[model samples]
Target chain A: MSDSKAEASTVPSQKPVPKIKDISLMKAWKDSKAYREYTLFVQSLNRAVHGLKNSDTVPLSPTLDKLIILLNQLDSFIDQCPPKGRSRFGDAGYRDWHGKLEQESQQLLKDALPEQYHNYIEELNGYLCDSFGNSTRLDYGTGHELAFALFMLCLCKIEALTEQDSRAMVLKLFSRYIDLCRKLQRTYYLEPAGSKGQWCLDDYQFLPFLWGSSQLTDDGPIEPKQAIDERFYRDLSNDYLYLGAVKYINEVKTGPFFEHSSTLYDISNVAHWSKLNQGMVKMYHGEVLDKFPIAQHILFGNLISFDPVPKPTGEGLFKKPAPVANQ
Target chain B: MNENSSSNTNGDIDRWLEWIKDCKYLPETDFKQLCTIISDIFFEESNVQPIFSPVTICGDLHGQYYDVQELFRTGGYPPDTQYIFMGDFVDRGYYSLETLTQLLVFKAKWPDRITLLRGNHESRQVTQVYGFYDECMKKYGNANLWRFCCRLFDLMPIGALIDNEVLCIHGGLSPDIGTIDQMRIIERDQEIPHRGGFCDLMWSDPDDIDWWAISPRGAGWLFGEKPTSQFMHNNQLSLICRAHQLVQEGIKFMFDEHLVTVWSAPNYCYRCGNIAAILAFHTATNHETKLFNAVPDNQRVIPSKTTTPYFL
Candidate 1:
């Protein structure tokens, strides 16, 4: 190839180049051009999720198998970074643990992605490191969770993850992410950076409920009203993401389910899972996107661009219902 | 408005105590009236009010209204016991409105018995971002009540000096601030600014570093033992008591006990699984500190399916 052709190849026409920058305030996400791009990014996540869910695949997903290995290795470091600090707000070991991950994340991303995507390793590593939590603050919240979700979306964007077995991205890969976050929270006693008591969603998570509700919104007979009924707790939580989140509430908190988890409990009164699903979207936009503290931490990269490029309508995330038979 | 518009008479205070005990909220009009009286009273307080000993210094109520009532039930209610609340009465919880209403009533009724210092969460900008503004709007069906409460927040004192020995503040020290006199000259009675000594007193945190560093919160400095020790030595103070971080044991002593953290919000954010504690200083005896735990959660309220959110 000619020198000019080699140089031109460096700038991929399909993927917009990432605008490298530090963290930004909510204004960047609220302004006209950036807001459109941000909204489009959020919408892109929905579309990518839909693609994965709609794709058909059996067990043994190549993408999840590789990503899970990376996440588990990170989890294994918890033993090395044992909770040794005296202060209960957080353990100093978390910093050590996150530091270890940060040092190896480059190699970890290389190992996780297929050999073909080696070129994207440096760009991808940013999302993975940011997804876990803030190392210095020694805290995790919805912002970190959002970062993790974006990692999976970016995975789909790079085509490292095929449209094959889309649902596993939600059911398997994201499930593993939740498990890892739960372990981090449990091991380090990670404080919720943006917790609003019962006023907000779960301390360390918000996406699971959104995706989980979407996962089972149309899957037969899981009623939203069953949330109020204690009898339904075991059954519903066993099969769906939303109920699983409710089960988590039951685990950590020791008060009346209604009083402590009122936001979710009120959500249960919405009659159907579909409306509840939309409400979850609205709630996420308000609590996670509109809130300055959490949104300010979100960074923009290459795959997730700051350009307002419109796409076809049918490509939305929640467009087609993915089959749950794999689970 | 005039101070008398919502003066806390014995009857009004008794009703507020009842509301707090029941974990119920007052009507918006009643809340506004109480806030007015408290705002008027706060206007009379200095930037750093001087408090004497024999008063209990509690920290970070954060709308754990029942837990606060639990403090009153176990330790003793204000006025009779003499309490100094180191700010952070609202936000990140369910009942910020009720919590402030009850505390303001107590302050209006007996201003000297209770000391209310500002916390990082007290500002209008913060409350709007956190849960308090949403809570007030939803509770009152208007923002007027929230605006009234914000006015009350503006008038709140920044810190307190107990018996001219111990210093009590919501957050840690600042490089911009040298002495207590430097803080006194700061013009208060407005929304907390993005920077300066006023914001640092309410926003900064204590770290184990040697000197002052920028806070991750983007508003104040992350002060260290060097500055804390220097401030205490120069001010001739025995200890600087602060309450911002959620300490697992509810109280943390740093820099060889020269600086202490007292967090009264138990099981912070309803799930921290931590105990809450308050510090009591009996001035007559060289300001010896005594600690009290929160009332064990009894699951007392009959669990009912209500839409209202609850905080620990």
Candidate 2:
């Protein structure tokens, strides 16, 4: 093909090809436009989310101050790069510049106003899917990734709350996530695993199922074989024995059981041994505690609240209190 | 007057008042009540008065019971003079309950001689993370008793003015915290939250610089030396003695020897095999603080017999 024909084919029908200088000028103009728009959006969103009106912006909150420091650091790093207009591939440069601008803008929004940014990202992600069907698009992925990051930030905030608040928030978040998972008919990436190597059912899910079964049997009047599995029976017995030992030891201390670390260790040991015993009973035919004589020491350690206390039957051994006589 | 009968009547009245005052264990049980109890127990007779002699200060016994026993051997048991135990009686160690019990028993037995102030660990949050809450759950199957103990722990005084010289506490100086009374007025009613005023009070560490430094462990801010020195100077205290940091010799002096750290529990948890010690204070013409290693005799080494089944 002739050079003129190739040039003509490359040129668009509606617009004429520009000179290299004009192209560079045009690219600079485009980049500045994108940067201005992006920065304005980020700053406005940040101010709105943080409740920072003109008068209130003098001293930044600790969280906002940290974000500003991070943004300044990013700005300094970005300043080291060559301007987009100077590059040979002006279109590629523009695309790269736009991508960077979007990323930094999203990051700034996330750092400055996390919760609002997260909700915004989630909404943006949904809109991208519905409007463009562009799941494979970089912008779509970036939006979703931002949402995920925001979700993680929320988790961190929830974790950092006071214990009582954290507990309440955890239960609320867990329930909400579980409901979301059910609605989507898919497991959340954050779901904790169960013993059987499956995503653990939500507490709400398991409770209703267990309660339904019990109600069917009229509050568990069914035969043991039908009503309870061997594991259930074993765990029940273990809990009973361990809790009993704990109660007895607490009485011996005459103080809060937790006031001593040894007491907890003893209780944990009993719980562990009970689990081991349950395992052994399920696996072997004979009584594992008797066969492995050392196991007796495990129970004894837990009972006496000391390792190798002289004669396991000392005066300080945690003995069950005698029944109190009625007055 | 019948000298014997009159003296006996006065003694009985004092005893009656003392019993009434000692019955209240809460920290808010009135300073006057505490004064009455202390006066009845130690100051009634001039012979039993606590002299302005030297006494060592120690801090942060996080349930290292054996170490405390060792400390007694090393620092010399109280009653010869006086020893101030700067709180943190429970958590971290396997014997927090035992250690606290022993300390409480000792305090009860020797009311004026031993001083026990509350540390951050004595609060609910520190105990919860460091094993107090779970230990309570396992030991008692109820959390209320732990709650009560924590409340009691919170009511503990922040610092003790020893012979009007050394200031003792679990943590070091904070930029916001300028005086001992500020510490005393801290609402110790709740467990320390992760951040804010309560956390800053409990988690802040000392530094010897002009500005607050970031925490190396990412816990919280550490106050620089300038502020610490300022606080010490402003309070007119010569030395700021504190605990919390684990020192190699169980004690360390920082901030150009202006601050001293004394650890009473040696070989902390058998994991941190450091030499632990207590400070002995004697104020003569010049105040002299003596550091004594407080490791128990029995914990020096494990016995071969105990290691063998035959001993068992």
Candidate 3:
């Protein structure tokens, strides 16, 4: 899974991974406004992702440039170490690989974030560290991926990322993060944590399709049949986010497009990309955010607001608990 | 609802042997009959039923009909070998309706030999959310079959005990269920509740924590050594056998061998890279554990992409 695109000797500085900052020292994030901030965060990301519909020839931004370089460094980093444990499951080698990332995560975040936001690096390192994958389980899922998404949103919250950079973030950094995660999945053979089989949007990803679909919201009409033409998807991917994701889907899954990826298959048949994009967002909220097992392990820090909403204590106010996927 | 109900007097379940063995679907009529027969039998059993020794204990089929057949064949099929399945008979896999039909038929055919307890996925609402409800629609062209299966799940037991020595359940311990008898009066024949003991029995996982904590799964509580030890000791059982979490080796032992998790679906969802296992608890003789890997030749046919999504 080593990317030939990333050259050797691109390692970051030889410094050890930084210590975690005490987030408790920050003002209590559990205040009522925390949920509002969460809503605002999602709203901002929605606008940012939706904004990509108008972008075609915009010049690339600096934040995107730094993220691309960081991805390359991480890309080369994987090539340096060989996998250590069993062939398929329970690979001990991924532990060392992730540990190396953990050790360098603080440095990696510092290198990825713009210089103006460098001072907040200590506070932000915890989420950045959690964004990769769990070494103990040796798996990646929507949970870890959500961590990374929230990590990026934290960058935005701190003004490290801004509305101006949103379009480029999706086009470059977010897409690149998807690429890195894909490489990790294939190279390390990471398990799809609590996969719901083909019922899910994609085995290892949901954000790409969500953001990607938003990017295609204004692009006239899309037919489900168009998704079957792999070559067509590959040709159009460099220009469209949705096509890029479909291209990646084609690369990973086998069998028919409709068979292995029914959710996306259904999306293709929708009347318009705008409706498809809207549906994707709701699906994320329902299947990913609202689901307990995925949301349970999620840590609420200063940026994401570590507040637990007190349960409503009356009839008809029930939260649907997450069933163990695939039993 | 279907007005006519029949008892399991006809040995009609034996008729579906070829369909299940060939990995084919049961006719819708035969499926309704099977569901009716099993529901009648389960309606008589308590929430915490009793089982004798020398039975094969299996866990979490997860709609893997092929693995279900594999386990039965490996364990020396039917009346000769008693089988106890610890819930999760549907969802995720392609042949959920077909697989579940086999278990219902067997329970009807050999009422004394087969025991099927309800797992979390057995509920009507869960099936509607997961693949079973969709698979039934795709295969049978209606939700009638799905409705029958849900009715059967409502009547199913929540847990079972073998020779009063081992307690078997789908998930793990719950605070509400102390004596096995306590579960008896909590009500049955309704959809599983969203919270309380009924939900916990089907959702919780055993963790390494000291006391009961909120389960990450949210529906069930995460119990540590204290609760497990107390549960087994209070019940006067040597071990608590369960299935819910995916164990890479197919079975995992935690908390000083007092709690065992046996996952019977190998290569879960056809991609989990896991193996399946069954516990052979023979009290008449010595206790034994049997493990099996998923069939290497197992074939999965992808559901059609052209199928439109159904929003409920």
Candidate 4:
């Protein structure tokens, strides 16, 4: 996993790698270097953020603070582009905010990342720019969330962030990024991009629940169902991403939890957080990584190449047979 | 009416309707049968379905089953107050199976009283991307019902003409189709195409531009007032009624009253906070928009642990 450390001094390729050009390459995506690193990185962050709270102090990193400031700057732009008099969902004003992000993203990335990593700004900027939301669609979802994660992954590969920063990345930096995303969502009324509505975990995100569930591990005082209880959610939401998301849903939506968010409500029925966390990881792989609609938009490059990894002998024993060519 | 009612003699459609009325889905076998029955009914209908006056027009139910019940309540139950649901009956909401099943049962029971046009979301690809496919797997523990429903979707008519004047479709006009007769000639029994008249009819939206522009949705073109009015004039239509786009107001009249959008899923996605509306046409020249909000929580049946989809 630390092989990236060896390549830290090497400059990345000049041009960004081509995106998942077609959906047929989805099989290749599973075997890509990026997929391997992403799974490992997510697992590491999952372990790092375990039992953490928004209030709990973690090892401080200047790089994390810079990223937070960059997010803050973008959040302030929402004030600049207050939603136009509402027509319906996906306000036009979000386009303006996204436009601002697009224009200043390179500069913002330059400021946040250490000067040593400045050479990687070209590739880094695309992920950071797309991380906010789509300007044209005025929508956000796990695809954009994936972009932010990729940005952090780029940072990790470049050694701008290291193993030590994983905990701070999940607790401090990623938390701020989601906060900014929420502000943009509420302020601009960003639509959910390719949302499965009630079937999906949440409208705008998937990872926080994955990482958040890890925070709830070790048979804590709260059970899975209790996470949605107002008494527990209100008290623990700040401490746990999963509960905070439920609290947000409660605020924005008006209906029984089971009716509006049946998927999450059903998930709450699981007996333990560890089980839920493991399920979340598998789901992220199945639902997000494997789904063409999401995977098609992912940009593949040096840090996260689309090139396939060598399939280990007898690997087919554990995995389900690969799906036949898509119709 | 049609002879399809004879199939309901077995009382399965009625039983399914009763189950759906109570917010439950039909059993897997019954659901497959209903799909077979409804697909046959829709297959016999034309690409441009012919609708009568004194009908209520709706848009995009998106599977809000309780809101649909409220809609039936607001605008009298079908057959009493005939309906032309301009597509989008599934996806996004929790009760897609029930909402779609109830509508299908209504069509199967009273083919003459209700018209179900195809929306973009009706297609197999769209359902896979949206919630309906997952909902089927979650509820039935398999994708067979989803496959049956997708077949039914392919069989649905793409457009409806009310009194030969008001052309109602899930989306707006298509550049490939200048006349409703052109729409009539389409072979629509397959997944929606990426382009051409058939796809455009189910994916297009109206804008204030002069002519056709590329739609952001990727499949259809963004038709403006000029082409819309020209299409109406060419077809001698008085109004073009569509339902693909959400209007903050339940009903929106655009292009100087030449086009109208009727949305029927209130508080869409359980959080949009926008009311839904249905248009009741008293005559070719007259219609009323009936508005309704989302059903209260207590009014809707909450799903037990055994029913809802487990994230795993």
Candidate 5:
């Protein structure tokens, strides 16, 4: 009986061997100690961007040119890291990365903000707290913090552009940001776990901000009402959309979103990535003051609209339809 | 002449005595023995076969004790008919220990009738998370009874074939299980803690949709309609009945009307305001199965009598 079973089990065998490219890719990632290397790369890029912004040797446009180079380098480092198929980092690694990022980002902001803009920085920090801290608030999760940080980065870029040629730079920056946002929005909502068969923003943990026909508007000078509404809406929308997308993706790919094995860091990462995408959209439109009439009315209504009224919560911001392609 | 007559009489007497000595003892004077002999002669008169007239086929009580009693009141008690409790007697409710004890006492009294099977929640890990662990600690002040109950849980049969027609189990079809005997071979001993073992048996959800796959949550895999239809076809079974997910109407039919989920616990944990039901079927005739709501008269308040037996 055993012999018969063994005979039955026997089959012709031809198996493929690992290719040279596969081996080299594995070796490169393994040798690079990608996690630590990526961290260092991010830090260096941050320093390079800051140095270029502060350099006396170059004019504003040339300085931005150097900054763009640094940004490209940062993007390359992220690409090379190759998030897919990497072993999940343990708590220690996560904590180490989180601590380093927090420290570096905080230092960068402190150094970048002028002494006169101390009050503005304080207000920004306070806004961050209000947006991210309140449990009732939509942005009251780790993902919101990441989204806010990404938004800050966009602001920094806008500031840099404004220094060179106020009107042209603003228009250019706004257009680019809007285009990027639209692209990301389409990528996230339409394709959903794109052709690559991977979750778009694995680290985003916030709930999706947009629910049932709501979109952010681009207003000029961030008026008190527009600013408050934008802050609240974006924070909440980002939270809901990011979380919802991740959950949807997880459900399709896995079984359920939140389960025994899911970690806090995993959720946070997905949330952060989602915010980055949304911030990209917001920043893209930040400079394009002419394109969005209604948005302009909501934000800079006193300047643009002859009939100005008290801005109700999300009244004007929600009037414009979401972009068709993104929708 | 006188001597000859006496010898004849004595010889007759001696033959009679020998016959009496050889005979089995029939003690007329021993009252106890005499009583037993008389009782044995009339024993057939008292031999009465208990008639199990009606029984309720309960599915997935799931630690909802209040709901179980509500069911009992609605369905009536056993001995008149028996209860074929289809397992999942613990977990996910505050009163699992009471639920188990009440069912256990009922089973002990009527072992031939009140039957229970092993469910996924009957496992250690499930109990720990759901309510059994806390219930045991609160009731017994120790984990000893919990451990014993878990042992008994292992012995529980995975599936019950009702009158050789209706098949009942806690969960749905598995790729591994083929025959009734295959189910019987499952060792009712300590189960190894793993994904594919007894845990999956109690926890696996069946898919009625086409092209099912493994769930990423690591609990169990999902199935599509094709596999479900094929399973039903191969098994020579009429319907696949299972309970795991919450059913709004205490039952749900899925998979092109092939799969049915019957949840016996209603207003599940006093939340999820759902009506609970039990499936009743007559074996003799291929009559359509009946669904009975075990919900109480007042929907708002859970009756006090329904407090789990372990409390008393």
Candidate 6:
């Protein structure tokens, strides 16, 4: 990391590790190379997961298996740091578990990746550490989920995970990450930081809806309306990320599905999976990426630079909304 | 109670109340009319509207429409049991439109029976960030209803005084406002500003500190027992009742019972697994607490199987 100054002096054009200093620079972030790369990477993975089930056979690289193991090890820490008897919504004992994660995460990342990638651990660990919920607030949200996505993008940028591993990225590593997050949410009773209650998407994650909708695109079995049906989600959950998320919500929350989950209920009214997938991509940009509250916490580094890419002359800064079919 | 309280208006309000009791929202046109009718009633009230004893004081509703119904069932409905709702009527929960509409209709019908004080969430900025703005857009396909609601929120009273002894507000105290008279001088018919007495009254919280401290919420000050006691003593108030933060026990009294936070949204956001309560004052000093849980799934109406709205 100390070499950043020398490298910047030598290259003259390289941006120093990106840090989101304020909300005003968010427009520059939208025009940044990092933002483009991140979204492109996510769309690539989204395409890779199209028409695929979790159970379907796919090659898992050793790097992914080690990362999954790291998540598993972190999961086991929850048992050791069980929530103490407390009256508050967020348990205090989570601070202890988070403390443990902070202490061991760097070493854990070193073990998970090969020696060739050890140099990037300092930058990578920040994303990995923040991927879990906040220790102070004892809550998790789509912002933390964004950290994990950027972590994956960093892996791809560093070539630790090749283009061939894109399918396994969402199907395996990301799936395992979701499981760990759900466990943390339940065991620790993490609050939904800055949640819009039932009006927003699900309390914790939004990627599953994005990538999950992609899995259902075109030849996928279920339609948008049928996704909420218990008969479909119950059996297909293990096989589909979208159903798994839907099933998870149904388990925790009480009340009618449409009422408590009005946003998804409205989304359920969409006719086709492809249209839903397109809308979800748009939603992720509007809700998660463009939002100042969520984006403020995002870290820009050597891997994810904040320097904007120069636009072609006469191009509009704001692009028109992508047209949807059957609107 | 006022000149607008005609028999026809009462009948319309009664019908709206009945319709909302089923958890249905008034149409946009009807909702606009309700907001207009109630804004006029609210405009005539002072910043700290005077309320009588034997009224029920409740906390944040947060769009939990069913739990609000449960709250009424537990504490008795308005007119029978006068209510002073200390703000936070929308956001977080599923039915913001239905929930706020019911309270507004009740206020329109029996303006004298209920005191609807504004909460922090009532502001245009806060509601847009929260669920109320989105809920409005989703329900009506536009933000017109949300806009009308925000205008109504601006005109709503800030605090209520129970026989001039207990001060009921949405959030907590402001250092700039030491007396209740200062509150009255505030021109509160606009968006809540970034700072000042008006903003602090709705955004501030009570913390374990000595005097005024910067609040983590970024807008308000976190005043300790010293400020609380001083404000109460200055205003000759016996108690300060507010509802901005969540209380797992439904009601929490702090600083030796000088201030209390009554949270009426149970199992907040459908997951906190907390109880809700309301304080029923027989007199200004003596009150009974009624605790209630979230409305069970079976008790609430599940939507009937209907035709699919979308087709490929």
DockQ of all predictions against the true structure, Cα-based: 0.38, 0.01, 0.13, 0.62, 0.02, 0.39
Stretches of candidate 4 exceeding 4 Å from the true structure: A1-18, A218-221, A311-327, B1-10, B307-312
Q: What does candidate 1's lDDT look like per residue over A1-327, in tens digits?
A: 112223323654342223323245345455423345335444433433431332234354666788889989998888888987646556667899999988998898888777877776666677788888877777788988877776765665566664454556666777778878888887887767767656676777887777766655445545777855668768656455566777777777765555566577666666666666666677887788677677666666555555443354323322133233333
Worst 10 residues of 6 chain A by lDDT: A317-326
Candidate 1: which stretches are off by over 4 Å? Answer: A1-61, A217-222, A228-231, A235-238, A310-327, B1-18, B216-218, B284-312
User: How well does candidate 1 match the true structure in TM-score terms?
Assistant: 0.86
lDDT of 6: 0.84
The clash count of every prediction, one per candidate, is 5, 19, 2, 0, 31, 1
Interface RMSD of each: 5.6, 18.7, 5.4, 2.1, 21.6, 4.1
Model 6 clashing residue pairs (backbone): A18-A300
Clashing pairs in 4: none
Residue range A1-327, candidate 4, lDDT tens digits: 345544534745444554677877878888887787777778878877777776678776788789889989988888887778666678898888888888888898888888878888887887888788888777899999998999898887777877677778888899888888888888888889999977888888999899999888655658888888899778888778888888888888877788778878888888788888888988888788888899888877667777666567423211222222211
Q: What is candidate 1's lDDT per residue for B56-91, written digit by digit as tens?
A: 888898887767777787568766798888989998
Q: How would you encode candidate 3's per-residue C-alpha lDDT over B135-191 as one tens digit per residue?
A: 787678899988888888889998888988788899988899887777778787889
Model 4, B1-312: lDDT tens digits are 346756554487677777887888888888888888887788789988887798999999999888899999999997798999999999998889999988988987898999999899998899998889998898888999999888888888988888988899998878888888888889889999988888888888888899989877778888899998888888899998999888878899989999998899998888888889999999878988899998898887666775332344
TM-score-best of 2 and 4 = 4
Tell me the lDDT of model 1 at A114: 74
TM-score of each prediction: 0.86, 0.43, 0.66, 0.95, 0.41, 0.89
lDDT of 1: 0.71
Question: What C-alpha lDDT, on a 0 to 100 scale, does residue A144 get in candidate 5?
Answer: 34
Off by over 4 Å in 3: A1-58, A68-168, A182-195, A210-327, B1-17, B26-30, B124-130, B134-148, B193-195, B207-214, B224-229, B254-257, B297-305, B310-312
| Candidate 3, residue B197: lDDT | 88
Ranking by TM-score: 4, 6, 1, 3, 2, 5
Docking class of 1: acceptable
On TM-score, the candidate that comes out on top is 4
- Candidate 1: deviation at residue B238, Å? 2.5
Task: Please state the error at residue A95 of candidate 6 in Å.
Answer: 2.5
- Real contacts recovered, all predictions: 0.30, 0.03, 0.15, 0.71, 0.00, 0.44
- By TM-score, the better pick of 2 and 3 is 3
Q: How accurate locally is residue B95 in candidate 1, as Cα lDDT from 0 to 100?
A: 66
